[model samples]
Structures are given as C-alpha cells and as structure tokens.
Target: MTAVADLFNLKGQTALITGGSSGLGLQIAEALGTQGARVVISARKADVLESAQAHLAGLDVDASWIAADNAREDHVERLANDAMERLGKIDILVNNAGATWGAATADHPLSAWDKVMNLNVRAIFLLTQQIGRLSMIPNRYGRVINVASIAGLKGNGPTSQPTIAYNTSKGAVVNFTRALAGEWGKYGITVNALAPGFFPSKMTRGMIEKVGIEKLAERAPLQRIGDDDDLKGAALLFASDAGKHITGQILAVDGGVTAV
Candidate 1:
C-alpha cells in the first residue's frame, strides 16, 4: 500500500469507544468506522447505545453497542471480553466516559468530587490497565485515547465555569496518558490524549444554551468552537499507522484556545 493510503486506513481493525453513545465519542467512532474499522460503542445506558448503533448503521459501518458502566469495576473487563468475543481483537480504545459537576472552588461537595474522579480518572486507569494486560500488552499493539479538556490544561475561572474537581481529574488524565505511554511504548501501545475546548454536546449543553455556542467559539483564537471534523484527523493519526512512533502526547482540539 502507498504510504498515505495505509497511513490513515483502519481497515481490518476493531475499535471500542467508551461513552460512545453520544458527543465526541460518537464522532470518533464515525471517523474510525468510515475508515473501515469495525466499531463497538459502549455506555451505561442501553437505550442510548442502541440509538448510537442505529446512527452508525446508516454509515454502512460494522457497528454494535454494549451497555456498560465504565465507572463499575467489572464492566471494564467485560467490555474488552465482549469486544474480543465478537470482533476478534481490539486495536483502539477511547476512554471517553467522564462525569462533571460544577460548584465553586470553596463549596464543592466531596461526594461530587468522588463521583467525577472515579469515572474520569480512576475508571480510566483501571480500565486501561485491564485492557492493556489482557489484550494490548499481550498482542503488543494498541491505541489508547483519553478525552481531556482545556480545563485540564489550565484553570477555568468561576465567572466562566467552576468545576475544580473536573479540571483536576482531567489534569490527572493528561499526566496519566504521558506516564502510561512511556511505560507501554516498548510494548507497542501508544497512549495519547485529546484536549478539546468548547463544543456542542450533552456535556456542554448547559454552557452552550446559556452563553450561546457562537460566543464560546469566539473565545478561541480561531474565533470558532470545535466541531465534529476537528477530531477526525487528530484521532485518526494516533490510531492509524501514521502515528506508530508518536506517543506520550496530548493533542489539543481547542481551536487555539490553549495557545491563548
């Protein structure tokens, strides 16, 4: 195959995206599926996952849905087991399930912090470890993509949105990607992260409805918010052969938000 053709092709591969029922995860699934990878989407809600399956069906992609709570300990391994059982072997895994609760830095509840941290940081770590040991590490090939945010890069003031725990968890994810990448590089497992800015999705619905998506888009240097296609090439590079040698890195899909 030509360099560029094979560089981006995901043909004959299998990808499993967590929290894939909607938003960024769904977008990434579409990109990988369109490129010929059989995709499996997992989420806590069966209804949502079913809907996502239908959404991808029209794309003519080999897609399926599994109901799994990534926050739960057993669900992580189960997801990998189910994927391997049905799809053969996993090549791409996106740790995209996360929880965010907003409160002032001074008054945030510890319970809320625990909830966010468990799913955002702890779950990510545990799931990745299990999958790595059971599949990726064994095969000596895998791609792990964690979804972080601009908050992870820097603080978001209260006037804008105060979710101290959210930022802290994502920061952990950023560092986790780097550390895990270093540990797994020799094993042919590349760990990377996508730090996205404002985008319209269930996660950002509140902000968009109140502030207007245009206003948030304009905050960045590009004078725009992130969109579906923004993550395509960035994610594809990391998952495809194009990024075989790239690891321990975080790619920002924030329309220059982090640069400012």
Candidate 2:
C-alpha cells in the first residue's frame, strides 16, 4: 500500500541545519525543504541567513532562520532552543557548518587550528548532544546528517594544498558519526555522514581557482565536478524513513574521486 514515492515524503517533519546560509549547507536545506520538511537554518550572519530564507521562499519551501555562531557554547545552546521553539520539533539535524584554514602542518597557527576544530568538530558534538537530549530522544526518533569531506578519508599528498586542521577535523567527523550512531541507536536516531569531494562553493573557490576546474574534474572518475542536484537524493535518503534501517554509514558524494 506504500507507494515508492511516498517513502521519501516528509510533509510533517522538521529539520534544523547549521551553516545553512550558503554552499553545501544551503543546497542540503533546499533538498529537505522542497521535500516537505519545515526547515530552520542557522549561521553566524543575519544578512546571509535572510538571503537564504528568501531564496527558499522563492522555491516555495517552508523555511526560517537563526543567526548564531555555533562555535560558541552559549550560542549553540540558544540555537538549539530557538530552533525547537520555532519548528515545534526537530526530526532531522544537519551539522553542515564548518571552517577550513590552509597552511602547512608545521606552520599552521594554533589559533587557526583551534578555530577550525571548534567549529567543524566540537560544535557538531555540542549541538548534537543538546538537540538529541531535548528533542529527538524524548520523541524516540531522529535523523542526523553530518557534512564531512573527502579530505577526511585520505591525506593530501606532499604537493597538495595544506589544510592540516581542516582535514583532521573532518576525519574526526567521520568517526564521530559512527560512534554517535552506535550510541544513539537505542533512541531510534540514525546518524550518518556525507563526505563530499570538489564542489564549487566559497570554501572551495580558492582551491578550484588554484587547481583549475578542468584539472579537478579530471581527478574524479566521472570526469566532471559535482553539481547542485548531486547531493539531493543522498540527503533525502538519510533524512527520510527510507534510511530508517541505515546508520553509522559514510557516503562519499564525490565523482568517484575516493575510489581511485
């Protein structure tokens, strides 16, 4: 009696996505919102959050936003509280807010390293804990989708760009997803991660400029870079009942870059 297309229906669910103002975060937000989830996006900038909210409106997606820095403990707490207040309940949580600093390992600044870790890893842990405790656990159901990167799966060659801290933090996310899934399974929460390769975003603009888009595309077996729609299906799967039985998994949304 369940239609195949109905498996992905999220008409009554709600999602909270951090760093959702732009880049991969915004893309994921669009996917969930269009699929029928009431979405609440958060980031550090009010201006950008407003823009993203407007963009979602244009697409006829039900959406709202909060501007808060996830790197701060107080801000994280407030964000989780405010999102639940606005959305009524959070059925899905997307930890997509992240930062990166490009520098050789030995020359990387301790301050920058801390900054990246605080945002990319620690923020995720804190938000997940709070949201899980307050909403998902009590409800006995939830979906957590972490936006890791392909950089976490492998080390950059000696000649590659130096982003030691960024890579390290993302690697932590991969394990974090697995560990959290193991612990949260009892609560009916499914935790998984998406490790994306070369996507055109503010974060990767510099790298794409340095390496050239054609060269980067060549690195993938598909011989092309990822586009807007590439991550939608995978995101929908993890956030929907379709992935109820799937957890603790890491899916690489690269054009087969990690395979080779």
lDDT of 1 by residue, 2-97 (tens): 688888999998898998999999999999999999999999999988889999999988999989887888888788788888887788999899
| Ten contiguous residues minimizing lDDT sum, candidate 1 | 155-164
Q: Which candidate number maximizes TM-score?
A: 2
lDDT of 2 at 75: 99
lDDT of 2: 0.95
TM-score of each: 0.97, 0.98
Question: lDDT tens digits, residues 1-260, model 2?
Answer: 77878889999999999989998889999999998999999999999999999999999999999999999999999999999899888999999999999998889999999999999999999999999988999999999999999999999977788899999999999999999999999999999999999899988899888999998898899999989889889999999988889999999999999998
Runs in model 1 deviating more than 4 A are: none
**Would you list the C-alpha lDDT of every candidate in the order shown?**
0.89, 0.95
Clashing pairs in 1: none
